[model samples]
Target: MKTSGNRVWLTYVLSDSDVPNALTLCFSLRRVLTSRRLAVIVSPKVSRVSREALSYGFDFVFTLDEERNTAGLENEDFVKLFALTLQGFEKCVMLSPNMLVVKNCDELLDKEEDVQQTFVFAENGDSSILRLRPSLQVFNCLLKQLAKRNGTGVDSILKKWLSDQTSQLTFIDDKYNQHLHEKASFLREEKNIAIVNLKNKTPHELDYVGEMVLQLWKSIYDKSVLPLLNAVANVRNQLL
Candidate 1:
């Protein structure tokens, strides 16, 4: 897969239960961003209906089995690494499924005159908006580096990567990666939250997304697309 001229956004689902959440993320991306090359890497555990729903929002859908090299990692969390193998993209942005885009991402990766790094990452998280120039060699190097480590989870691997590749990375605005540390404070500060992180998927988190989804729909699309997106979430919630 050689996607050297495309601007692609990548994400993945680990189980059938994550289908709806992933779809909501896709719909949110489609609603706010001008990019059309959104893709989702779904696992074999997801149902056909869930996959179909995924396809409705994304430009392309891939399965974990297709990404053989990414299999066998602890918790299947390494699945996000599949973005490196994505074909036909000049630039790739790997985003977590729970991140809500509060701003247009069309120029998210445009380098500033003062900047020198090759990557832009949303701060304070293992993974959020990761903008990178697609390179298989670099990804392979990271894989080998990760394999040599003793730690076995996404956060540990990510921290190691950041520490090792600090020269290549620049931080994006913290506002783009907001967290709900204090629920009341977050609610009071909704005006400042850009891309929210739904880490635990708590009820308030879902409710926050519910309200934001409506705002996104009203501002970009209509209410009709809500049911399908909601159905995807409902299905995943049932599995959870």
Candidate 2:
């Protein structure tokens, strides 16, 4: 597949079950006309079928090496560290698959270029969205730190790591990573909100905000993702 650009938007899927969410996120980014290319890192648990489906939506579909696929949530967080090892990209915005991009967020890439620090995170301490300048040195350093601080929450580990760094941590606005559990009034009034992190909750489980976001996600899936998935499936069957 062709590269979208030097800067890319990225997500990760640990298993086949996460494919639908990842596709929705990708299509949402496209729907918002995000200029950056899209990419995903899939764990070994994600099957070939899922990877093929992802390739239909993403510019790059990366698989985590088997050795890096350790167990537990901490290990799962460890998988995300691979984003730093991506060689070609000068900058990458890593977002959770459960997030929906509601507005054009190309500014994130532009803003990141101005920052002196190598990493950008939401001020609210949500690791759901991150902007990073990918480097093998940074990735290896974090990997060692993570190993030493095993069992710590990834957010905490990251905060501690940044605290010790010579460069100060740069923070993105909270509107870019709004959580689903925020007050309904806040969700409704936030006109500048660029992305909504669903916290893994389904529409039926949430209030009005959930339904509204779910409708948007469904619209993208039905109008964009579903058709592409169908086409990919048909081609796969024909090849078989």
Winning model by lDDT: 2
Flag regions of model 2 displaced more than 4 Å: 1-4, 68-75, 185-188, 200-210, 238-240
In angstroms, give how far residue 226 of model 2 lies from its true place.
Answer: 2.4
What digit string (tens of lDDT, one per residue) describes model 1 on residues 15-120? 7777656766676776675545788888877777678777888888977754445434643556656566665576667777766666665555444521333356
RMSD after CA superposition, every candidate: 5.8, 3.3
What C-alpha lDDT do the candidate models reach, one value each?
Answer: 0.63, 0.79
TM-score of each: 0.72, 0.87
**On residues 19-38, what C-alpha lDDT tens digit does candidate 2 reach at each position?**
88899999999988888889
Model 2 shows how many backbone clashes?
Answer: 0
Name the lDDT value of residue 5 in candidate 2: 81
Task: Look at candidate 1 and give me any clashing residue pairs.
Answer: 2-88, 3-87, 3-88, 3-89, 6-90, 20-232
